[model samples]
Target: MPTYKFKYFNARGFGEVSRLLFALAGQEYTDERFTQETWPAEKPNVLLGQMPVLEVDGAAYGQSSAIARFLARRFNFYGSGDIQALEVDQVLGVVQDIINAMIKAFYEKDEARKAQFMTENKEEKLPLYLGMLEKLLVKNGSTGFFVGKSITLADVTVFDICDKIQAMVDFDKFPQVKKCRESVASNPKVKKWVDTRPVTEN
Candidate 1:
């Protein structure tokens, strides 16, 4: 078996899904976490100077989505087959749309522009993407997952993003989406990790 090392910041940001994957799979890996103050000294050594990087048997790989997908595939968290994988990817894409909108709002410089960006995200982007997610969950039989009957990369990604945005977005109308998140959160392995993992404001 290849040894693994996952390097990311102390926060959940883009790194939590991969951590949840590790927990769900019961796979043991070195989780190397950094703080914002300590990141600069080590940033130069990281590939592309970005984090949530995974090292497999000493080989470094970057990109949060790529890293998460690779881990998901390795741990059987992707899906059963090609078609299911496509479905999982579709949900992942929608989650990315939400994350992108959040990122835009998070980085806006002008206060008024930032508020406008946040408003648009809350009023438009979230509803569209989250509604699509809820529909996908319902289409899959309302099993609290977007893919097959069990949890997949799609479910984990949705759960992670929803946890991040729950405070900012109203999920009362998206019951299925809430159920999907609850399903992941209530899982034995995932719950264990969440219970023990560092708490972050994000």
Candidate 2:
């Protein structure tokens, strides 16, 4: 197979799932990271000048969520039945909202604003999203995953999100979230996946 070039950044943020997805699918590729200074010169050279773009035999496709969904459908992490597949997609959508809120607030930052954004995140958005996920988990029987029997795209991304928050999104009002997060985080493959991924400043 012709190898792909996955161009992202210094951290796991958007590119982590692409990495995990590729790994889980048993596909081979080069995972490349770039600093901000280098992007200006390098990005324009890519087919679309954007990323986490996946290049398959040198044809490029952009959009992180699109990449994730496409890869999931291809690899069977999307769930088995039609309804289950849609459920897998729905859960992923909800999880993406939480991911984006934090990315908007903290990831793309000037050095000075971290403290203030962290306060805003904990006090406002974090709890709301966490609570929603916990409730969804509880509603679904807290089944050690978001969808059906096997791990899906939602499971992979949520596992990544939970690990991202350990240093920050503490369990005060959101204690139930710990159960949902722990269920996936403890999966041996997922634990190893998160541990191996490169840390991004974002």
- Top lDDT model: 1
Candidate 2 C-alpha lDDT tens digits along 1-202: 6668788877787878877887777777878788888888888787667778887788888888888888888888888888887777777777777777777776756765776777777787777787777776666677767775557887777777776776767765554457656765676666776677665565
The candidate that achieves the highest TM-score relative to the unseen native structure: 1
TM-score for all models, in order of appearance: 0.97, 0.82
lDDT values for all models? 0.92, 0.74
> Which ranges of candidate 1 are over 4 A from the true structure?
none
> In model 2, how large is the Cα lDDT of residue 73?
82
- Which residue pairs in model 1 clash with each other? none
Could you tally the backbone clashes for each prediction? 0, 2
**Candidate 1, residues 41-109: lDDT per residue as tens digits?**
999999889998999999999999999999999999999989999999999889888988999999999
